[model samples]
Target: MKNYLIALLAVVTFGLASCGGGDDKAADNQEATQAVEQKADEAQQQTQEADNQANDNANQEENQEAANDQAAAGGKDGKTLFMENGCVACHKETEKSVGPSLKEITAKYGEDKAKLIEFMKGNAEAIVDPAQFATMKPNLEITKKMNDADLGALADYIMSIK
Candidate 1:
């Protein structure tokens, strides 16, 4: 009877140890699952950030393209810029006011757009009315700062007047 009791107690102890091991395994598995979930969440957040940055870059590129298109449309933008930049205050389409008229300018410069552009840059002599060039010198401060597209547009609008 004594030996039988000892054998039974040993079996019970072994059984309890095995059951506790199973619970430990379950806890380990739960921790592993939580770790994997955290990693997945981090990856998802990174992907979303990358997507947002790409969209912002694409939008900026689109805005730049639209600006380029508008600048290239010289007829509209050029005429508008010309009037807004105070060219209308000195120059006119027909009659000469503070400077030579557009007709006089076109007749003098003719098809030589190079000379016209050069005059704006303050590099060439004024053939339209050399005597009145001193009065126009102050205006070059404004024209010299203009980009080529704007200057071309301004010239186009002026030439179109005739």
Candidate 2:
């Protein structure tokens, strides 16, 4: 009977020790979970801030484009006014058309700003694509009938075709 009691006591002691060790492991797991959650939260916050900055930059770019368009409509540069008024309708960029293409025109003038502006003022003959000049001749009559300010704007736009 004494041997039986000793064996029972040993079993109970071992069980208690095992339970104590398991408690410490549970605490460690809880702490590790808390750390992971905290790091995830920080990452989420950083991502949100980056997204907000991108949105702000996009908005600023859009605003800038709008401002440039408005300036193109009213600038004293003349070419900007012509582009704003849709003078590109009859003119093409490289090939021939109802109006001479800008590429050929620029090729003939070779970037002479003063001469181009003067030519746009209806003073000079068409340099590169005279074949289309006849078609545009009636347009000159119509443009001449326009107000001086409007005509200047159109001429400026013509000079900018390049």
Best model per TM-score:
1
Look at candidate 1 and tell me the lDDT of residue 117. Answer: 83
TM-score between model 1 and native = 0.53
lDDT of 2 by residue, 66-150 (tens): 4455467664434544455455677776766766677666667774756655555667787666776776666555555555555
RMSD of 2: 14.1
Q: What is the lDDT of residue 75 in candidate 2?
A: 40
lDDT of 1 by residue, 25-119 (tens): 99999999999999999999999999999987896576456446767764345568778888889888899998888888988877787778888
- Please give the lDDT score at residue 60 for candidate 1: 58
In terms of lDDT, model 1 sits at: 0.81
Candidate 2 TM-score over all chains jointly: 0.43
* Model 1: worst 10 consecutive residues (lDDT sum): 59-68
Question: 51, model 1: CA deviation in Å?
Answer: 57
